[model samples]
Target: MNTLLEQLKNKRLVWQANQQNAIANTDSTGYQELDVALHGGFPQQGVIDIDSAVGIGEIRLLLPALRARQQQTQRQLVFIAAPMQINGEMFAQAGLSLEHILIIQPETPEHALWSAEQCLKSGCCHSVLLWHQQLEVAQAKRLQLAAEQGDALHLLFRHKRQLSMSLPVNLAMKLSPHAQGLSVQITKRKGGWPDNPFQVDMTKAWPTLTRVRHADNVIQLPQSKVS
Candidate 1:
């Protein structure tokens, strides 16, 4: 009994310590449908990866969180796009404030990577988004540690194949745009079913969610809202 009590107390202390130094602070993914897809919302100080090919639903997936960061009461929102091009009009379309976002177009991928690392280290922005097709384990580990040090969320966008392999990620997943629908599959998670997969239709996202037969599906919309 004493051992069990001591173990529990130690666990609490560890949790408290994690909270104290935790960088895992976030509001919500801007998109309601996507937030439900992510099991709640993205972690504040944890590292999250979004893998998608060009001209897919990746932009849609990030809109929610970007919007949320722009709405944060704490700090400004920053996005560093080295490989991809982010336009002011596109940001406005996603409900992200142009003035609140500091867009850094690095001359090279290396420079952009450095910018991202520095941004994470500074712990200034409410959130940081990095566009890189390849992320080495070392780089990810560094960002992960940085996120843990301060309360910040790092969103790394890579390719679809990136999640197919083992990597340094708290949650590894792939998102693709279907026929007016969005499909998501979990590659890895800290403590979740690796085989669990889910999808949400774009049309069913905003006002209502229309349930469909996607083998075993996990619907997260309101009962009345679900069709």
Candidate 2:
């Protein structure tokens, strides 16, 4: 029995229950508050489901982490079916390499899924962002498997709605716009508990994007000087 146990351990097939509870490999999320909440940062490579409306700092929150992943792996970052044109200046400000980024717009949702799966399975991309509204369980699972196979991160962006069902993803969260940055609620996480809504302050990184509140309960934007 001792020899068998040693062999299993050598094969990396055995682990303590506590090890399962311990935090897995993660990269810094760039935001300190988010990193603490995530017990490190985002998962190194897996599916991250973000349920939020478009153009509300959702992509901003992820840019830093994506850039980190790309830098660490020296792989391309692919965006599929993005709702709007890719903003080069914004991503550049976040330190992502423009030359390493690729954009694909599929004609149909089916094609989008195929493109995303191929990109994730190609092993040349560090992260793939797919802006999709709907997905069945099997499709989500396929994407998850592809990400694992190629050692990449898959980010699924969708509309914020009450989740009647769950997808097989490593992390799932809902985001709402907040004055400071974003109000985030973790619906599910692989090796952690669901978190109550927490504020991810973006004021320091993006003062213009956040709302400023006065002592009298009035909110306003920081005015930009006219060019």
Candidate 3:
């Protein structure tokens, strides 16, 4: 019995080692600081959860890497049940080809999850991004399995409130707006430490200028030019 127990322990160790090795193989996220924090970037193929406040530019944070992946693979980038309409011109200005993007609007969250899982399992897209307001652990698990089966990058955008809920994803990050740009905190990662929050200047990666009104009845320049 003792010998059998030792054998089982050894097998577990081997499995863990293999998992770590697999996670080590990742693609760059296009931001040097983020890449370092993630120990490379998003896992080559798996579910990544991004939790952020509304209108915080969560999509913008990932635009650089997503654009790079699309260009490299020349495959479709699918969006499932996005809460808001994606502006093709904005993405185009940020270096992503609108032709490569496919947006799907599902009436319900269940349908959105189903569509996203199908897209991942079909291996038809290079990457799948889904915007979901709420997600159960079971649904997240299914998505993770589908991602593994298809070997496609799956990214889920959810509200920051869902950060407390546990999900079986390869990586989970929280994005908050910062003075410089976006503040990213890795809440969970497989085979990687949850280090301190790091700042990624996504503003430079995808520049957008907007006017602002000052208190003294003066029009302020764009935030990018303020400092």
Q: Which residue runs does candidate 1 get wrong by more than 4 Å?
A: 1-27, 30-37, 162-165, 204-227
Q: So what's the TM-score on candidate 3? A: 0.79
Please give the ranking of all candidate structures by TM-score, highest first, separated by commas: 2, 3, 1
Of 1 and 3, the candidate ahead on TM-score is 3
lDDT of each: 0.66, 0.87, 0.79
Estimate, for each residue in 1-227, the C-alpha lDDT of model 1 and write its tens digit: 87977896774321232332312433566556545655666666667877767656666666766676667645667778746676688678767777777888888888888887777767677678788876777778888877666567777878755334566666666776665556777665544445455664565443233234454566777657556
Runs of candidate 3 with Cα error greater than 4 angstroms are 1-22, 162-164, 206-227
Residues forming the 10-long window of minimal summed lDDT in candidate 1? 14-23
How close is every model to the real structure, measured as TM-score? 0.70, 0.84, 0.79
Query: At residue 176, what lDDT does model 2 achieve?
Result: 94
Worst 10 residues of 2 by lDDT: 11-20
Q: Residue 116's C-alpha lDDT in candidate 2?
A: 94
Candidate 1 lDDT for residue 89: 88
Candidate 2: C-alpha RMSD to true structure equals 8.1
RMSD of every prediction: 9.7, 8.1, 7.3
| Model 1 residue-pair collision total | 8
